[model samples]
Target: MLQRSPKDDTGDFLFHFSSIKIYNEHTLVAAPMGSGVYVRHKEGDWEGLRQGMPEDVHVNRLIIQTGKLFACTNKGLFEFDMICELWRDTGLVIGCYQLREAGGQLWAATPYGLWSRTGTGWHKIAYSHVRVYDFLFYPEFIILALEFGIAVYDRLVGVWMEFPFNEAVTGLAVFEGHILGVTENGTLLHGDKQGGFEQIRFPHLFLFSIVTKGSEVYACSDRGLFRISCIRDQITLISVRLGCPVTDIDCNADNLYMATLFQGIQRLEL
Candidate 1:
């Protein structure tokens, strides 16, 4: 059941949330840290969807690829079975941090390495021992935010390139044909095609996640949710304060979903 409490002055709901993702078209899935995953269909109340998952499973991220919903958790990767009303483990067994789709394939980022599903088996692509925080798919390369630096994998040449960064990147997104990244110390960086990055001034600090929608890039930070415009050569930022710290954010055609540190999930009209 979805807990209802008094809203703050900024109209923010009060519930702990770890991440949020849009499922299918009308369904909203949210992970409230240790409480497991919950689903809300169209104007319906949120319902827990932890039937087949392990007890107290901690989901780190949620993603939809090829019309199927997947959850990255501490136990491993699990695919939601809509027909069965439960989650089935994908048998990857290693802890997954994030899941992404690029080059018409599903990719999983884990502490062990980056793995991809091929046929009925999973293959390791890169980053065997390094930890990957996030990744983005460029034109011909797969860009990764690793524990210590940035890595770019060229698909056409079948080569991997790495560039060291002073601070660890916690999130990644692409804007206006340039790579944008948020570092662990809350610095926003803009990178070119050659893997060189330059710092851009960002007001809010302690940013954890970032996502791009259309010509705008939204970043989640301790202060609030900052929306950056990618329209002009110079970056512009607009802060949307919800009176709480935001941890993650996602968007679709109609709505922008925010996962807050103390609030469960808030949906805003775009």
Candidate 2:
């Protein structure tokens, strides 16, 4: 069963949820299309925690690293302090699309290229002209979903490589030990750091995001929520109706969270 979030600020159901992040086992934070951010604790109501944040800045993405919460917006990256319930600037003020923490370092993906944190400061690493949408972190490599193709940054060898798929990949995931790419045209592509990427034929899917829990992978698309399962040598996809387009999907231990285009948040039992 899907349950409504106890307290959503958009009483008129006009707010479109842009992104959601699982802060902890008991808390979750979400970014609305035009609002700052909202938080929900265990069995509590959703409330705004926008203090110390810029007024009317659109927050596009959220992530938690080492028990600290971070939000990427049109202005810059802001860190949320749990103790004060306030936000602090991280000083990479640009058009950031996504944020990731790998190798105990924070990485910012932007149109100006990629930036990584070293010691206490951030420095540019790669791609000044290309826009990166997502990342898949492995122990030895970081795979990026770029505007034109997939790029791999090898941490062990300190080398950069590119795989041009000629398709605009919107999302990336590591499922069953393979790098999966979700293209804007609704095709699924898989590849490894060594070999090349190949397409997986399925019904045209308008997917926006992809997430994995254990062996199961879930995708949020215009049609609904889909579960991708691989049994033996066969791949199966099952769609669940949401009656609304899903923009983002996330999961905790016991529940799956779906942020909709205009319906706020929907909680489903895991």
Candidate 3:
């Protein structure tokens, strides 16, 4: 959700929003690529939430866990202190790409590897040398989208199983017991936990993010937004072009929100 700051009357616009999230039912928070984080209430102007953060920090992702806002940024992992109205650095100073909560624990994907936060501090769990992009929990397994392929950690066995892929994966989602992943080159993949992934053809190129809502899966790309439907063994793609490059997308029960590369945030009514 990039735009001119509320105080900027010069008509200059900011671009390249990386992530967006609907928070607390009435607030919308967005992370611009290099401008830290911003928040906006319903129909209100966007406000910066950059206190205690470095100037021009790159925020890659945002997540709400335990009713608190956490940001994955170039500097480190930050938790927003509502009382102080500032972001508190959690002391994990690596470049974090994504954040997730599974089994009541907080996890972060980074260039170094996959890390989990404990009551003590952050610990590198696995893939110490590989870059992790995204992750999701499936039953007792933790599925990760890594630079080379998908890796599933069998919690019961305490070992990691690798599923080799040709392209680097950027995002992942689960739908109806199947794992769906979008590659950096715009390829959509579907497979089970056993690592048998097959490409699902779609027209969009340069996919940036993937998300799921109810029974539907949505992927945002340079072309626009696409809705994927999986019924029985048939897969369907429905395109809803917004005339701009959509970098990220999320949805709730009443609306769908999109963060475009240059067009700020777009909202679609449900």
Candidate 4:
């Protein structure tokens, strides 16, 4: 990615991985550290959705649901329309956070609250005094990973329950019938679908991003990309020669894409 004028003057690698989302018809959207969301169509790559982004704000999350792509930044949430080839000003907004699509709507874990996005508008489903660092969604509940521990909200019971781990939970992902969480110490939690978490054999490195699909769990920490079993019981290492920190990692049907501090998007055939 050719950068025009850099954002951070001293930060040599001006970009990082902010968000990774898979879209319909096999389209994938990646919001890397620098400027915009790079859209991958089929086996090709393009960075068209990044136009008209806020200059002062950096994209924190990317979500694709119901054929639309969304970018969450410090300024707010912006929606990109695929059919129209432009960004729709639907007034959906959120602060710094992560996002994932579930069921029929999109969920964002913002600093001040948890917001849900449908075709209608943005609505707050939950709010907290402290920031919500990350979240995971299953068929029955939404697991909010916070600075404290884990908060489970039951969709069927209309009740919210929290288990205070008393430590910062940084990353969240799910595979098979298991929920995997990465702590600040890079400790991982493997939980059954019906219950809570139990510590597993996660690496002891500093972690920044994680994603899981099928039987694979991928994590990006200060070290590099770590591949684990679906249960996080076994781990494998994939070294990255890219100078900057590993930003995010994701895989699709044909390729595994990784974004580094400012290396744009690196694609490897699966």
**How much does candidate 1 score in TM-score?**
0.87
Residues 63-152, candidate 4: write the lDDT tens digits: 555656777776677787666676655465557567777777777777776778777777777854777868887778888888777788
lDDT of 3 by residue, 1-270 (tens): 334466555553355677888888888899877888888888778888989988778888888787889998888889999899999988788988888787778889999889998998899988879999998877788889999988888889888888877778878888678888888778888884455888866654667778776677887878888787766676666786657888777678888888888778888888
Model 2 lDDT, residue 41, Cα? 86
Q: What is the descending TM-score order?
A: 3, 1, 2, 4
**TM-score of model 2 (CA atoms):** 0.86
How many clashing pairs does model 1 include?
A: 0
Better of 2 and 3 by TM-score: 3
TM-score of 3: 0.90
Q: Write down the lDDT of every candidate, Cα atoms only.
A: 0.79, 0.78, 0.81, 0.67
Which candidate number maximizes lDDT? Answer: 3
In candidate 3, stretches whose alpha carbon ends up further than 4 angstroms from where it belongs are 1-13, 192-194
lDDT of model number 1: 0.79
User: Candidate 1 or 3, higher lDDT?
Assistant: 3
- Lowest summed lDDT window (length 10), candidate 1: 1-10
Q: Write the per-residue lDDT of candidate 1 for residues 167-244, one digit (tens) a residue.
A: 777678887777888887877888865668887756546677777767777878887888877555676667875477
lDDT by residue for model 2 (74-141), tens: 88889998888799888888867778887778998877778887876888878878887777778888
**For model 2, what is the C-alpha lDDT against the true structure?**
0.78
By the TM-score metric, which is better: model 1 or model 2? 1
As a whole number from 0 to 100, the lDDT of residue 200 in candidate 4 is 54
- List the candidate 2 regions with Cα displacement exceeding 4 Å: 1-13, 154-158, 192-194, 200-204, 231-235, 240-242
Q: The CA-based lDDT of model 3 is what?
A: 0.81
